[model samples]
Target: MSAVTAPQADRAAPARTASDDLDVVPLRHWGRWVAALLVGLVAASFLLSLARNPNLDWTTVGTYLTKDFVIRGVGITLLLTALAMVIGTVGGVLVAVMRLSANPVLSWSAWLFVWFFRGTPLLVQIIFWGFLAALYERIQIGVPFTGWHLVDLDTNAVVTPIVAAVLALGLNEMAYAAEIVRGGILSVEDGQDDAATALGLTRAQTMRTIVLPQAMRVIVPPMGNETITMLKSTALVSVIGGRDLLTAVQSVYAQNFKVIPLLVVAAMWYLALTSVLSLGQYFLERRFGRGRRGSAGPGVISRWFKVSAAEGVAR
Candidate 1:
């Protein structure tokens, strides 16, 4: 009887293990319900608002869409964005290099640049640049030791609205871009720089040929984000009569008295532009991310990211 019971107990041990594995604990996802309610409320409110406004005459919207003035506004917006990015990238690289330089002057200059630009309001800066031209009529650029006839800086001629926009946006953007670039540069492993130095490459050559290329792989996505942000930031240029999209919209509504509708039109265009930029960013990120294998494509990666983020909250 003891021998038979021992065998039965061994068999029962396996069954108990299986039972434990199969046990279903009650897991509560309380936040999921809360989130669902919030989402539903927001959706309902949007639908109800649109329904009440029923005046969204697509024909009027379509008619205003192709106007030459509006088209020009979009063009100016793109132009300002592009100009700011160019200036930002060049200036950012310089400041980043300066920050990383061995000389204290360069590093302090870079630090001050970032500190001041990042600290001040961009709108105030633009306005200041626009008005400050009155204080200085002309600037004289000359060699320190001898008059080598370097070009003069004509403040009166150069401080136009366009110049003001560029100066304001470009200077402001450089501060942020400098940090972005510096971070990306630092992200490169120390070994790479040491190897380049070992190979007898000058610091500049190593940076240009090796570090920048690799750093770009990290830099492009955030740079793309900055580009998109700069596009929206160009709207602030209108304060200085820069004539970008938002200003154009303001002018149209101010004159036409179709304030809400015209503003909505402006918003629609901004949304459309941002949507296009977002797609470009997605593709750019995908292009940069391609060497890593077994990774999902850009769109799916973004979707999964969003899903995982939501899951974190749900848990």
Candidate 2:
């Protein structure tokens, strides 16, 4: 056989300047000044409106802020968010792993879980769980009629508002969390898994040791987003008579008849809570983005001044 000719090697390409490679332009600094003015004006207008409300009960607002009921309600809200997110994150990991599993049964079950939870409204789920006992008067846990002293799932006993709230929030959050986890896992390069396998790691071991740690870099931003969402969604527990932050505000407002003021209190708490979480999310995202390549983060000013001034010219 004739000797095969060697193929010519291709040279590495040069890096392109962003301006040359893409049709993008930075905004003028004057646009930033305009945005600042607009934000200040809106805030000032809102404060002025609050000051003009003659029916506003500052005393009641302050009283409710310090009241045990409101305090306890807020505490419960935080607890529910924490518990639900923890349960949801755990469930999400399982669901995501199952979804990516080779086993058809596991994949199907996980798919069904995500489909059903994501399809239904969270409020409906909360209501269903709250009234689950109404349908099955009592859930028996014993083996048939053997009475081996198993558990009894009485609706009245087991379907308390708090229990129902946790179940609803956890299950609802699981669907979204699953997607977040799946996306994060997929974002990892295939080579990472291959490399782990080459080192004599089983698939599960590779995932636990190699994949998850890398995936977390992508997972944390969305997790923070979900945590914040769950915080607000905890308010829905109020519909089932679970007194969370919003519900406590509602109770106070209903009795005192200072609707807007009481609502303002609730809004304030939500703002404070979400703001703190938002700051935490920013820092967490920054931490996760370290050592990563381009666009890991936009500068704080850029983050604030992202939109074009003309886009909101009429707002």
Candidate 3:
């Protein structure tokens, strides 16, 4: 057999065949498209109807949206959220640690705290704090069974509406946050603790430096959600006249008899605030999820949108 030279063989390469080319057709989910269209239409119709309804008093909504009372209420709401979240987060970590401690007393104490707070309704707790004076007219601090009262204060003066609101929200949130933190801590592998021990690190040092840092990947998403929930839950403070956003709106509507419009204003502000918090949460989740299993730089929503776009192009 005669040997073929490299260039001669290349010139004799196999011809392109029709079978090699594929005309792919992506499957269309018609039901999804129909459902999405129906939802969009209904939402648009509802919005337009609200816009055209004179009873809604969109003008009143615009009028009081940025009024001084409403603005102050917004500030108060933000303050309550920040303070409550701070208290909850700090107290949560402490409670979680206690719950995990070797001592049964510490663990039982933490459990009882979480159980009581979680078991009761948060609104009831707020009202309880608001009217704590009803339960105890005076708060005395001193040696028990001894007639020595170092500090004595009226309950009403000490636990004002704002104070009551903070106490209620923070303590309630601490219960839930305790569980979240405990779960996160537990998510860290036992081997990690073993490794830390082998490295001659104390338990506290191991947790503070190695374990907690790793557990943040599990902790941050739920904690962010809890923060948002705390923001919304501040509305309940209005019952005690804690001067939250809802309280300001209620005050105006009560005076002017424009309940719906004022409520619309409050709803708008709440939606806006929650949207901002959700955006921050998305970023935080993305940050913490880095290098973790099943974490691909982008988040679920972003990935979903990308996938939908690619599918659209394919179609």
Candidate 4:
């Protein structure tokens, strides 16, 4: 081997620096701690105020909290929520498919369905359905242009207030759900459809087995939120006396004049139900998010202090 050149030997070893040790001392997020402390103080104060407020009539809240009527109302509310979601999800899938169909007629019909239902307020729809007898005295199932009434039913008798409530909530949910489903489906790349076709899959089969399962990764989050929203929307059925939680509470408050307490009761139940749904959504997302980056992510404190890969790369 050749002897080291004098010029190379003259260059001193690179000077040591703090970074040379690779000791990455993390920064303390003092601002996050300060903000959290302030928020905690505010929340504590607000809760204290609520506890001290005598006008809330906590006695009434306790009295009717688990009353038979209230329990029945809770059952009815859950029923409405479940039924509406079932109708909405099934109808939504069909409507979404129609909206994406090649035929202009099918597409336009789906569009019109979404536009009309989503355009009108839920209250109007509920009231219209509740009072359908005013517009059409009877609901008749007969041959078109043949005047052969196979079945005839009184509108008032057939479409009860609860039925009207379900119809309104379900149809309205269908409109919004359709858009959510369509958006999720569209998030999938066109290549997916081509791949399915190349594999000899029918359109329906492709949608059911391939695109939809993949699309669920996108669909679940918003659909979860919509479900919670639908649960809350059941309160609107009170206007039509659908015997939901709010309607039952309203009846009690109407008699006792403990409006605030009754309202608090309803709010508590709604909160509890929504919290349960949120937990379900969280677990479902975790399931669908397998193998995705940041799916099961850092905690709030760590996330605040964390650095991005792109930032590290840039450095």
Candidate 4 residue-wise lDDT, 234-273, digit = tens: 9998988999999999998899888999999999999999
Candidate with better lDDT, 1 vs 2: 2
Candidate 1 stretches with Cα past 4 Å from truth are 1-38, 54-60, 139-156, 293-315
The superposed Cα distance between candidate 4 and the true structure at residue 242, in angstroms, equals 0.2
Report the number of the highest-lDDT candidate. 3
Please provide, for model 1 over 1-315, each residue's C-alpha lDDT reduced to its tens digit, 9 standing for 90 to 100. 335587787877745455666868899898998999999999999988875775765556667777888888989999989899999999999999999999999999999999999999999988988886677767667887796647677786778888889889999999999999999899899999999999999999999999888888778888999998899899888887888888887888788677767666778888999899998987877777788675336577778999999999999
TM-score of 4: 0.85
For model 3, where is the 10-residue window of minimal lDDT?
291-300
Worst 10 residues of 4 by lDDT: 298-307
Highest-scoring model, TM-score: 3
TM-score of each: 0.78, 0.81, 0.90, 0.85
lDDT of candidates 1 onward, in order: 0.86, 0.88, 0.94, 0.92
Cα lDDT, model 3, residue 177: 93
User: lDDT for model 4, on a 0 to 1 scale?
Assistant: 0.92
**How displaced is residue 51 in candidate 1, in Å?**
4.0
Ranking by lDDT: 3, 4, 2, 1
Candidate numbers sorted by TM-score from highest down: 3, 4, 2, 1
TM-score: the better of candidates 1 and 4: 4
